[model samples]
Target chain A: MNGNGKKKRIGVFVCHCGVNIAGVVDVERVAKALEGYSGVSFSTHYIYMCSEPGQNMILETIREEKLDSIIVAACSPTLHEKTFQSVIELAGLNPYQVEIANIREQDSWVHSDKEKATLKAIKIVKSMVEKVLQNESLEPIRVGVTRRALVIGAGISGIQSALDIADHGYEVLLVEKNPSIGGHMIQLSETFPTLDCSQCIMTPKMVEASRHPNIRILTYHEVESISGYVGNFKVKIRKKPRFVDPDKCTMCADCEDVCPQIVSDEFNMGLSFRKAIYLPFPQAVPGTYTLDIENCLGLLPIRCGKCKEVCEPDAINYDDQETVFEEEVGAVVVSTGYDLYDLNHLGEFGGEKYEDVINGLEFERILSASGPTGGEVRRPSDGKVPKNVVFIQCCGSRDPENHNPYCSKICCMYTSKHAMLYKHHVPDGNATVFYIDVRTGGKNFEEFYQRTIDEDQVLYVRGKVSKVYKEGDKIIVWGVDTLTGRKIEMEADLVVLAMSMVQTDGVNELLKKLRISSDANGWLSEAHPKLRPVESLNAGFYLAGCAHGPKDIPETVSQASAAVAKVGDLFAQEQLLHEPTVVPVDEDLCSGCGICVTICPYSARELDKEKGVVKVNEVLCEGCGACAAACPSGAAQQRNQTDDQIFSMVRAILRG
Target chain B: MRIRNREKPFGIEKPVTARGQIVIIEDRCKGCGFCIEYCPNDVLRLSDKYNSKGYHPPYVAHEEECVDCGFCQMNCPDFAIFSVEVESGEREPAPAESVKR
Candidate 1:
């Protein structure tokens, strides 16, 4: 290897990309313009350098001309940087010797004037040529992968991701903050459009995840902290105490029946009662009961062991303590899902003040077959069937001044589903929906909404509900009729608010721990909006479900599978090869000052106590150069841009 | 104020009188052009002259053509315009004195 050589022969290849570049900028002219540049041994143009035929031309030229370095002027390097890097490597050249200049996205697409676009392409090509001349041959850095994955939150999205990843022959650690695996899906009576029972479809998947050999399901747990980079992450999970031995428990209801302490059942949206030792739902995965220690008689000062006395298996234990375990994983997939908007914030609707008002999730519980009233269309207050029910759409969505400005995307369909469900249950019941607009653009979604209105005879009112007030036995709904141009009022026994979806709590702390990016709305950001929707800027980490954005069941499941595919591709290789363009710390010049350590988003740098200097972890360094710029002593130098390289590049541009 | 005499030789409907002033505050207008777009009577127009922010503000080009419908004020996001209706054939001083008493 000529570590610091002077006599270098460079080859330049310009791609037309099928009129993507050549339609406006003349590719042949660019090659000709750069023909006589210093040390340029060969110059050529191809219709598409990324295609098979074009790659062959580049490989052949490198061999024939004995090109020491190469440059490709084409689309943004983000699109085909890896493709060209591999092409040069196959030709027996260092992959780091290749540099790409963007001309399509930055030039032709943005500029209408052909002459200006051509000139801009020429300048970009010239800068890349200058940089390639001084390029040093370098070796790719290799890091060992742990080959295990972590799935956060045991919701439907997390369950799907864990199962898919486990089926790919990799170990997965599935962590959940609740006592059991079926999340919000288990609370719903039925799904939309198809009217399929929610538990009928969700229970099987939960059981499979629990029984999968490669998956270790950890319920009633949360990740406390995460350290190290991808391929070597040490995660600490905190398991809360359930006061019950999970392994020893049998599918017996004797313990729950004897527990006299009763609390509001969250599974029924707090509209029903539950024992201290009770399952979240009758169909909960693993089918075990959790002893709520907070409310349990044994944990309280009163000391009651009624549940233990009744259990034949002696599964109830009051002495259990919280446990912490650490696991190492190569990749992590965050699928924390979403929480429904709180209706109490809308004071105009008499939200929590009225007993008849409830949010969508709570309404789902009331409609469930196992709910308090056994799936009867009765009011929660008096247990009497109501003559009329009113559903409010966009209660906390699409209101820029007081609520979320963005459309929740699922409200319109779910509200229509709720109305249709009510009409099906009570034949003579009157159902009315107050909405600003109806968006049903999915497959067979529009037909479902139409059938609800035309066949089911649910009233569709076009306007916003101004206020809701309690009137002794019934809630009064006041709204303007945009169609009739008059104020209308209705007395309904029940009101359902279609709430918005928001990010799960403590997401910011997780983002900081993982060094991942989030958009303005706090959903995880992807590498590219259209191309790499499942991948993040950091390698070995992927996103899925509502953590990425507001998506329905079909879209969320598809994206979860996509993330599994990406992780599988990464684990296929024994060792991961990283770009040599990472930042390096000069041991001689570094002073134990840890300025770069704090500014590094990835925590790639640390002060070595033995050496009394900063040490850079190559695996964690993404080469963003943020730490390098923060270095006060100028000791942290990013590869490919050593001080000498940047100085020379600046001089070349200024001279030209 | 003199009302139309019923016994006149040539009897005709008395001309309708005007009302209180309908004021338009120019500075608060955002020039969204909603007033001109929604006006049914075609009494409002976006002025060619620019405001302090260099946007064409809405102006009542035909002041006498206003119908006092209040449609323009309701549609305006910035609340730049409003209308008032007073009884015909009443002097401004007389009406002010009756309200004060």
Candidate 2:
């Protein structure tokens, strides 16, 4: 009860939601039914409860009715809970006294029978009225900040976020599951619209992050576990062992010369070979050589020690073990990047059988000056220059029954870039592109596509490729040209499949450890797609780059910088305020069985051995109600949502 | 809570063997061949028949000679094959077709 309570006065407001609710539910009937409710002193109905006049009506009623609490029967609380709360607070009343019953989404929109739906709306409103009478006006709790940030997946997005946060004078930890800091961006020859060299633009940023005073980079490391929330979080990282010691060895070629083990080079998209003890590339950040223990034959039981035997500095450690460590930070930015469409899933395109068929990234490697063929448009089957090359767009995209249904936004522009680059390499070669639709939705991108068609003399055919096979040192592509209404078959020297981008493997497990929810399509969920696009639903966590979905370089960088701005906003506050709805322990009812201690995910509840009871860390509790649900003796009860209040609410709803 | 105990079953027909066996889900194989390359006992080889994905899945050529060093299980990039250890004195060996589905 309130301080000077003489029978608490409550008001109930019903909304039509502009035919969204009134089309099915009778809002006038709902307000009339609640007019004589037990605690309700006033009842009214409005056309739009979220508009300016509707809010003014609520504010004036709170003053005239002397109401201590108000229940708004409107749409879902996720839309208008804060709006009504602010209206009451503006009228010199407590914000917690406003209860919103979601009648539109939960009752009216889902049902067709108007008679039953209006009764259901009345029941839902009555339950809210019962719950509001028992609520207490509580203040938010204030906690201190840790003033540090962690960025996962040292890709282009991660690098940008780390640089932005470090420039804001806060310490940052950058963790990557690769040997180098640069992501897939460094593997490309050039970007679209501007035709700028990818490595030339990426190398400077990698060097700057490595030399930054406030940034600490941990390559070949992955997040193992995460704890706490918002301003205070603890993270555990697992570091894979690199057999060569970084401090003792120089970036030299002596180790690679002596290593006998050979493996496909991932940096070149497996188009080339490298020794087991080689660097990812020459311009790799940190400029250190890493020995892959998985492919190296010298690690287990010491079968071969050729690299260690020839090392002048004795830097090789065959006894290296994987290490696990921890770090504490106030905020997190996820930028795990993406993977190319698996060639295993594209077997129809002969990506696995024929050597001439390649993906977009592999074509990038071939066009690079440092790539396998040294910037020559030679077919992978043999080192012969191709006379005609075919580009197939949307290989595994926009096919709902078999593959991803969404369009890979970058394919059309990148395919245009590929055709122009191939034309520049082989002047007499003909370039044909089979596309579903030419989607150029970025700045200057449509103009770039037109320039490529006019200057490069590239053939654009609107169609889909049905099958691709190898025949007599040439690749045969069978497709249908929708514009001409005819089936067409052609022979080409090389075939490049513009495959779709997919989420990186094993990132779902990391998200589960952090308790973040992913969408049905497997991308990370944003707080709100329009209002709060950079934030994760959880407080103090942020999303960036392709981790949210597929996007281009400029959009990914903008999101990364925006995520850093949110983290900077967090660090600006001296003490952060948290929800005061945490659970409290009842010493009289606790059995000291330690069940609540083991069930809380936040580690908020602990058993007191001396007192034979359980104690709660009020600030750490998030009011998830796990401890209350698992308690055997009813010791852990929520602040506002209690068993007595819930029983009364059930009675009120059941009365109808 | 009440605790319950059960009586052990007797007179079961089974082979008494100490060797381990490996099972393969043919459709899941991408034919990376990392398993066949890493097998310490030379127990596996690439199959001639193609799975639904048109990639050659591996088969156990020397099943009787498998020591189950687990090198293939640990090294398979596609996770298409796994090894099951046999207890010293129980259980019947499952047929290859029985495990494929």
Global lDDT scores for all candidate models: 0.79, 0.84
Q: Report each candidate's C-alpha RMSD, comma-separated, in the order given.
A: 22.9, 13.9
List clashing residue pairs in candidate 2. Answer: none
Q: What share of the true interface contacts does each candidate keep?
A: 0.00, 0.00
Per-residue lDDT tens digits for candidate 2, residues A109-135, read: 899999999999999999988888888
Which residues of candidate 2, in runs, are more than 4 Å off?
A1-6, A11-67, A90-92, A101-126, A309-314, A583-587, A590-633, A654-656, B1-101
Per-residue alpha-carbon lDDT of candidate 1 for residues A271-300, written as tens digits (9 for 90 to 100): 655556788876676667898776553443
In model 2, what lDDT does residue A378 have? Answer: 72
State the lDDT at A154 in candidate 1.
Answer: 80
True contacts kept of 1: 0.00
**What's model 1's overall lDDT?**
0.79
**Each prediction's TM-score against the native?**
0.80, 0.79
Q: Best candidate, TM-score-wise?
A: 1
Q: What DockQ would candidate 1 receive versus the native complex?
A: 0.00
